[model samples]
Target: MKQFRLHKVASVCLIAAMALIGCSSQGGEKAAPGTQPGASEGSGQQVTLSMHSWRVEDTEGYKAIIQAFEAENPNIKIDFKPFKATEYNTILNTALQSDSGPDILQLRPYAPGISLAEAGYLEPLDNIAGISAFPKDVLAAATGKDGKVYGVPLSLNSTQFFYNKKIFEQNGLKEPKSWDELIATAKTLKEKGIVPISFGAKEGWLLSLSHGVIAPASYSGSGYIDKLLKGESNLQSPEFLQSISRMQELIPYFPENYVGLELNDMRTLFATEKAAMFINGSFELEGLKKLNPDLQLDFFPMPTNDQKAVITTWVDGSYAVNAKSKHKPEALKFMEFMATKKFGELFANQFKRISAVPGVSTDDPLVNKMAELSQSSSTPYLMVVHFAEGKPTTKQALENALQGMYLGKLTPEQVAEEIQKSAATWFPPFKK
Candidate 1:
């Protein structure tokens, strides 16, 4: 029942924002990093920079975030084009090929940078900010095979188990420290007329978020997805099947009608006190808090079998420079601001995620707990969140496979086999 939550987990979009004054500032656009702004040195004429995104609810928070940057530097204007994930991707894939489109938008690291870089459509950004201190995985996600960086990560996070504090204490149970303990505790709660785990199985990302997403890390035996992506290993193998089998063992522990539950169901089960535990990302803290601010919370990194603890992580976040925008310089300056602690403090406090910048803190005790759990990993392994739906051809097939697995229609071996088949045809080309 510990499944992924979408309202809490962010998907890829083409995210971009301009650092202009409150809709009035003007200046030459900022550059991404490795390349100069692809415009005349200084053009002040109506540079209405637009960026597309699938994050609608988060826009207000992000707007507040960008406003702080805008207050500090009032030169470039930003127009946010917001849409749901599905619509945004559909429009974006089409827009990237058209003349009229956003300067930046949200995208998964491998898909956006790698594919676009291969197409020779993305502008390199290594020269401008010189983000030398940036974490290697963050830098790696942005860089194409040619070693050109196309974007920067705005936040760093790892998916973990988020469970009810009251439930554990009431059941005379401690938060589980091992897979066996988890099963024992969940059984105790379920027998008491309380579901032990809550999750949104209806969403494909949730399945991927909780289980399918970590195939590369588990299969490679390297214990990290970022490492596998760096030519460290192959994905279509039995080691990955081992991880999928582990998840399958827990299906009996999920709600009896688990397949009937949709994307928000499991989260709702926990939020309403019907379930004792849930597994999701730190981003869910905001919504979970809004429902019950006193919701006592704690997190444990996803379990491991003989291997070290691993967390499925998304190494990329929304925000990219347009390859054709006139206000590139101004946009990048704002991005620099985003890369600062001030920006992290302003935006990351509520989502409960750890900031990528050097310094930022939250008074919330739970966020600190998740951060503490992640300290064991070298750099957060971004590979656990291997994006299967890299393009239109693969997205639907992967989604169907996820749905089939949830319904018991597909066994772990079958799930692994189907995904393995897609991996050959679906792995998009690296950037040019």
Candidate 2:
């Protein structure tokens, strides 16, 4: 069996510092672009490259994936290093500033990726052969303002409701076809002494995610987002305010003291069957399974009043090469491999995620259903995909405002006003 090792964040920093010190001792210079540092074709020289990511939970999955790559390229070894998601941005920024970052790094999607590319921290991959495998919209997440592709798109995530199949069967519940039916079902579940929804508001990000799933249909999904982006509508508009109000409507169905609970608490409640439903991303499927391997689960999109389903989708993140790396040639080789259908299949099969590469399909029935929902009737995740380029990103503003609304410090109207005010401060469209 192929083998790979995982590194903690502190060890990753120490290893990087040691590598740079050893290079100095050898008087090593940065390799020219497109040139291999020490190894060449059949040269028998070994090279090790470091990769950094924010997914500490994906260690096993990445270990297997990296093993496949290492098996194919025997002379190249990769040290897969992952940090806590909450600290990754700061760690990556610090490493980049000191020129001690990993050869390959995971980048946050959209505006954050563009920021790095603009800062010259990432190598441009405009001419990479594998980049042609992705569509223009998918590539947009990692493309810089200068029109250069800076990373390989990894996964497309859909936010929806994951339900406990066993509980639904026991309660004689079927998937809700309309908003009213969904409310009725939640009421029925709550009457039976079961938590209708496993959700928490302690982390501001989770509130934003929950809003993404619950509120899209209220404002009519992409139709309204387009109008908002073009200055035709504002967050304080009636329809948008209704969207915020919808989140408040569902507050009664959430667990007691949910505002004090965090993500892990929410996941535990759902995975252990303490709750009947969970609203989250496609990325959570494997995690839930790991928590309870025997858990019987399925997912569905939130239904609209008109009976249409609306799933919110976004490119989660991507993999990029550090512009300062001495292993540019080998790092590019790995990037090429990541863009291949082979790697795409491995990623989808192992992680149960929706791979961004075109024509890549998953064996997981639930993942397949998510893809179908996305293709049939889906909207872009509004805040991160469009309004995150500005300072006090629309996402952050909405999250904070929602938290305040939940705490009884703000009303739905006030929440909408705060979002509009924050956006107007930096968002060009809103400035109009």
Candidate 3:
């Protein structure tokens, strides 16, 4: 009877939903609160909380985590919902606006999450237990402009190149340590009839993610974005514009009709051995493995023009509680569990992601190597984080400019000017 009761409770909380707003799936609507199989006979009612995240691939991994959490907190049940990355923000924003949002949500760290917090959609997590143990910089990445703690980071990820080890060996090439060497290496690979890189610009937003990894190392390492935020740097500056032009120079080595392809297609091109390298975040390792379990891969810091490479690192994702959640205590409980070292280890072990907790480290050597590279990460992709929070966001503006460039409709200068102009309402120098 006890076993059956536990299963019932799990079912209530772990219901899979296709659409977040409706909370309905192909399996039908979830069991309503208070009437679920394990609902208390009187005062101790069962509470089911929905957690929406963008990691659809991590669903099974999170289920294992959820099961562990359920065993400890029997009264509260958690349902994990996943969404496509490209459409996640739009769906989540819409849900929050309509008061139909989940109890917990995966937030894009920094400016994007802060924008929601400022709009009063997210709960302040100041009182959550063990939150103080998190690294200050990681915590600050999820903090709102108002100084309130809005989320707890899920993992640290950096944008870098994942190169095929076998491909490098076959070509007798060593990993490039400088920008010039990187170009020369790519040129050599192209001459050998191998696609040097797998990149997809069809979605447009990839320009931000891809370039965010390169721009910092190329221009001024981590200090560049900081300067841009402080009005010390602007998109029109030669250093910043040079990064854009550099991307153009390297474009020829990418898969043909690269802009017409999607990320999955590009990954396929890499996985099948047609491409020698793929630039993405550390989070992509698991997906890449699934595509080709035997494909040997390793990573290197994004090379810089001056040879002093800097990795682009930041708190990639965080979990925020919904301000309007009906079950705040339960939501807090789950988030508190997320902060525990036990949960951190579980997350890293299961998902192969680096934990945000101070003492926790991923057991995976590659993940640890990625962490080592982060020590040099200072400049983040600010337009994605801070500058473009309102009006035409820096991300949107920049991607449009990049798309225009891809189509040969705009020069690098014109693209930069368009980005500045697009962000004019929000960027200080361009404002009236």
List of clashing residue pairs for candidate 3? 222-379
Q: Which stretches of candidate 1 lie over 4 Å from their true place?
A: 1-48, 212-239, 378-399, 424-432
lDDT of 1 at 198: 80
Q: Could you give candidate 1's per-residue lDDT for residues 1-432 as a string of tens digits?
A: 111111111222111101111111123334343145354224444445576777665666667776675566554566776887646766876777885657766665544445554554455555555355565445555554445456666666667777887878887988665567777887788788887778656766566666532342344323434333443443445676666776676676677688777646776777877777777766777777777777776666654554455555555463666665556655566566666667767766746666655456667677666556455432233223344344433444555676787777988778767765665564432221
For model 1, the run of ten residues with the poorest summed lDDT: 16-25
How far out, in Å, is residue 317 in model 2? 1.5
Measured on C-alpha atoms, candidate 1 has an lDDT of 0.57
TM-score of 1: 0.78
Top candidate on lDDT is 2
Q: What is the TM-score of each predicted model, taking all chains together?
A: 0.78, 0.90, 0.87
Residue-level error in angstroms, candidate 3, position 85: 1.4
Global local distance difference test of model 3: 0.74
Residue range 124-167, candidate 2, lDDT tens digits: 77666678767666777776544567889899888999999999
Error of 1 at 17 (Å): 29
Worst 10 residues of 3 by lDDT: 1-10
Q: Name model 3 segments beyond 4 Å from true.
A: 1-44, 428-432
> What is the C-alpha lDDT profile of model 3 across 106-180, one tens digit per residue?
998666776687677877776678888775556766664344577888887778888999999999989898888
Best by TM-score: 2
